[model samples]
Target: MKRALPILAVLVVLLAAIAVANPFFLEPAGFLAFLKRAAPLVILAAGQYFVIVSGEFDLSVGSLVTAEVVIAARLIDGDESATWPVIALLIVIGLLVGLVNGVVTTKLRVPSFIVTLGMLLILSGAVFLWTGGAPRGALSEGFRVFGRGGLGPVPWSVLILLAVGAAAIWLMRADFGKTLMATGDNERAAALSGVRVDRAKIFAFMLSGLAAAVAAILLGGFAGVSAQVGQGLEFSAITAVVLGGVVLGGGRGSVLAAMAGAFTLEALFTLLNLYGISGALEFTVQGVIIIAAVAAGAIRLPWKFTPRKGDAHAAS
Candidate 1:
């Protein structure tokens, strides 16, 4: 909780600026709407947090989200009855993708960065070939409800966000979570202490995949189905997690702070929009944030590093 304060404070300041720029932001409905918009990224950040904290990266999620939405639209094809089944299938697909990523990274002894980057390319190319540059198909109203509808004054997306946040926090408190932290802090030590480091990382990747699936559902509903629906989301999630003070090589940070970082990011974007900043600069902003955050992390841990398994294997 202590590590989260910096991001929380930044969020508050950003929110205050947003309120000043647009008085409507102070209203409950306005704020709820903002939360709804930010929900997907927040969820993605939580997922990324797990992978990063476990000392891995998941660059595939953005493409995973795009693939999910595209797959859902094609499968459901406006059939309300197909909605739930399609959602289930999306979750399964996400898990499978993550599993593949983990297996390739651990078993093949490939770097996680390389493995997930390959996944991102694979998914993107698949989507391009399947859609021929443009995605087709309609989402059912039932499917859209999760993104656009709400119960009374609150949104279903917001509710889902809360549920995801709670689950993330709980997982981090469990035995697996503690071991994951340990593995990130010192993989060799954790392995010698009887922790199954490989399995733990694979699980982290699966969680990231699950988060991408859920985020895809929400995004497809809210933003509609498009080939570019999830463009740059992976970077955005990474930026949010890093902004929250989570270390890039893993072994640090909290889930809640990562979520707050998402909110802060959204607020920063909102502020920029209010000032007439071009939306095209979003990727630019993300690039700056990610580099800065990782540099900061490196500076903080000036002399810390444990050789990865693949590195040690090669050395031997």
Candidate 2:
């Protein structure tokens, strides 16, 4: 909770600023709309948090999202009856991608960074090849409903975000979550203590993939289908996680903080837009934020790593 406070504060401040700049944001309708728009990224950040906290990366998720959308558009092809099956298939695809990444990295001894990067390329190339430079087919209204529709004043996307957030928090509080943290903090010690470190990592990758699938669903309906839909989302998710005070090279931070970081990021973009800043500067801002975050984490490492006398006793 402490780690998440800074980002939460930042988010609140940014929201206030946006409200001032555009009073419409103060309204329920406008606010929910904002949440709807930010939900996909927030969900992706939550998924990325699992992998990051467990000492890994999931660069393939961005491209995975793109692939999911492209695949969905093709499979469903505006056929209302095909929507659910395609959605299910997308989830499966996400899991498969994550599984391969985890297996290759953990079993084959390839670095996760390399594994996921390669995955990103493979997915991108596959999408390009399949689509032949332009994606065909249309999304059915039933498919778009998840991204564009709401129950009364509340959005379906926002509801999905809440569910995902709650699940992420709960999972982090469960046994698997504890083991994952331990694995990230000290893999050898965790393994010695009976934790299946590799398995946990594989699960993390799977969760990330699932998150990508959900995000794709929301994004496809909200932003429509395109090869560029998930472009650079991987970096954006990473940036959000680090900004939330999660350390890189893994083993620290809270899922709550990671989600807050996503909200803060969305708010920052809203602020920039209100101020008439060029959207092209978005990547530049993200680069600066990531570097600063990693540097900050490095500076704090010694304090975080130093063991208290009780730690040894507690382990024993």
TM-score per candidate, in order?
Answer: 0.91, 0.93
- For residue 94, model 2's alpha carbon misses the true position, in angstroms, by 0.8
Where does candidate 2 clash, by residue pair?
A: none
> In candidate 2, how many Å is residue 224 off?
0.2
Cα lDDT for residue 24, model 1? 93
Candidate 1 residue pairs in backbone clash? none
Q: Which stretches of candidate 2 lie over 4 Å from their true place?
A: 289-316
TM-score of decoy 1: 0.91
Q: Give the range of the ten consecutive residues with the poorest summed lDDT in model 2.
A: 301-310
Q: Give per-residue CA lDDT, model 1, range 248-314, as digits (tens).
A: 7878888889889888888878888888767888657756765775576557553546354466667
- lDDT by residue for model 2 (86-160), tens: 999999998999899989989998989999999999999999899897889999999999999988879999999
lDDT of 1 at 309: 40
